[model samples]
Target: MKIIDQNYINGEFKTIDSSKRLTLKNPTTEEDIAQIYLSTPAEMDEAIHCAATTFESFSQTSIDTRMDILQRIHDELHKYEEELIDLAVLEFGATITTTRRRTKNAINLFLAIKEELKSYDFIKKDDYSITIKEGVGVIGVIIPWNANLAHLCSNIAPAIALGCTLVIKPSEFNALETQAFLECLHRANIPKGVVNVVHGTGEVVGEILTKHPLVNAISFIGSTKTGKRIFENCSKTIKRMTLELGGKSPTVLLEDANLAEVIPHVLSSAYSNSGQACHAGSRLLVPKAKVNEVKRLLLETIQKLKIGDPKNEETKIGPMINQTQFNTVQDYIKSGIEEGAQLLCGGLGRVQEFEKGYFVKPTVFICQDQTLKIVQEEIFGPVLCVLPYESEQEALNMANDTLFGLSAYVFSSDETKAYEFAKQIRSGRVLINTAASKAKNPPFGGMKQSGLGRMGGRYSMDAFCEIKSILF
Candidate 1:
């Protein structure tokens, strides 16, 4: 077993007191894969100071230099693709196929950043004034456990490409992947202290990063409740914040939509990542005339999903992250049953075949009451709530009723009508007759309580930059 028991600070791996350590478990086997010492307050302070001090010079580095560094990092990521995928399968309980796709996405983001930097204008000239875009300085990135590798790259790609120094706090659940990523940065020979990694619970490292005086901005990806707390903490110093929070996304199926084509998309949206993803289309709104048929189709398809060892290339649904998440999802399943929602397919308990690991059956509930708890809250599991709608206007209203505005979907034979309807939904991005995975760029984030800012493609540049106007 490979053990990573140190934090990366000042361009070097430094050891922490082993007495205070966090053990990371393989969700598939419920066994310890790696253990990392939690960074002390003093260690976090050292990282912040290193980043702040380094930014003065690192932020001024030439764009070509930054692009070269990004290219090196991208190449290193590809070189270690198989190893990273193996770690993800062991730590993520992720299927090999899913892990490969995620690794590809991570690599592609860096490549995209490099390509975009070629045309990005750091200094724009006008008649009398010159507009300048510079690094925001000392970024604090908080990554959630789900899709840790992909989200880690999503933030770091733009931060580094735009010449910002970073202090990253990846969730303790998957610190092994963080260690591997930091190794890539080290091998790529990035400037000393330009990037740092700290491992600990969010309360310890996360709070310090948000409240640290030297930190200029905070970029977070997690729950709305936690995002709000980070916002409140960063507001004290008037620091910039880009939060990508929770989502209870909805998918609206039009009356004329073909059931065969739409069911697959809907299933992929709702059950992707075993329904743990924030943007998972947890709510499926179909015309009342077709609710029964939709439920039957869902049942047939869901039952056919291979729910077992994530190592299998064929497995689509893996175990939940840990016992706590497993219990949370189970509670939500129980809540649906108790609240009078009809259980269409799966309900309660583990996948009988597995004795260990946190696995919940892919659950589907046909809900008549939109006001029910199951329909309103984010279960963050492979649970789908099927809601019936009588009219197009009603479906639109139902979809927009949630507190989250992260993502929405519309499927229709009429392309123009679907486009117009997408405009009405309050979401950061909308997918029409397609899976969210088909997105080309990273212009993805949340609106309302879903999130505060956008991060993807050229837009991510906006997150880690400070704009200034200079008179000629």
Candidate 2:
């Protein structure tokens, strides 16, 4: 019973006008674990007001001073990392290892962003005039549930470092974790009103945050359909938005690839978080001649990934977040079956070892058509569709055929061939062997529907900054 009913506003914990409150639930055991204050439009306005007021001073602060505060935030983050991980494990159904690793990565991202900002030339000076990189005011951040804490810090650390104040609307599914993270922020001594967290459904908190007058910019990570709606909403204010949307990314296995070694990459790409990630390598494409061999390897590799309790240290695959997600994943599994895809491995239902959690089995389907719903859509589940292609050109074509272009992977020992194939696939990020070794300094973002703008390093700062031209 960790109750996070206080919304951070103006350097204090205050309750909103709404009498209605909600308890954040842990889906694994169907337990109500924490309570949050459900918010209103007026509460959103108050947050925007505070953030806007704080930005004037925060934005003009020296880079060195800002870096010092960021360092403090990072250190404090590391101190509470375990408790944060515990909350993540309980709320999001992430395994203990995943929760701990994700927390470290998030804290690392904060450190990396701080270091990146230290040497960043955010302003230019002239004899008669000065060019400034001023803060974008009253930012609105919408974090996805899959990797809520890390994703929040990943995009937000840089923004705050660049002197931007923001209102964050973390996914309703992960509100309890967010409340705890905000509590840590307060403990870390981040100035209130500099960052505010509001809890509610998308229609209430999300829509209000997007449409707020003082909110000059927005950053959202979710599906393309939702991203499109958010983009449209912000268009009314002509707000600058960073949209990290959907992905039906492909893993291309060249004819020369080693099936045994490459199989691990395929499993990690497609089945991590039960394949709920935006960049999960869901659509795995194998060469026509090697299709059967790769399929067998993929099935074996995926089967080896431990699935069950989120609290288990050995578990690699955890339960789906909630009943809605479980049903959606099951529907996708059913979609593959009904669409005439050959069921090569897992089909549906719970793992034999776990009966209580909202779990989905690791499912694989071999489909001839690359354009089917299961193939083309963002299933966001453990289900993977393996498609065969006649030639390299066809593989690249099919990989780039989706409306979502978040990430793409190519596995080949031939460097020249890998780079050539990477160029043809239209994605924001491309993984030749692995996904950039999960680095923090690498610029993280997607191209096209994957979203606009970039994050990580100086890119994170850029999202929060605006340029001013100097004329002498």
Tell me the whole-model lDDT of each prediction, alpha carbons only. 0.89, 0.82
Clashes of each: 1, 1
Candidate 1 overall Cα lDDT vs. reference?
0.89
**What are the runs in model 1 whose C-alpha is more than 4 Å off?**
none
Q: For candidate 2, lDDT tens digit of each residue in 1-472? A: 7665667788777876777776767868767887766788788778888888888887777777777777877887888888888888888888888678778988877778777876778677878877778778878998889999888888668877888888888877776677767767888787667888777767887898888878999988888888889999999999998888888889999989888988887888887776789989999899889888987787777767888778888788888888889899888888888989999988877767765878788888998997788998888888888999999889888888888888889999897989998998889888898843655466667877788888767877877778888888
Q: What is the alpha-carbon lDDT of model 2 when measured against the actual structure?
A: 0.82
Clashing pairs in 1: 442-456
Please provide, for model 1 over 109-166, each residue's C-alpha lDDT reduced to its tens digit, 9 standing for 90 to 100: 9999999999998899989999999989999999898899998898888998888999
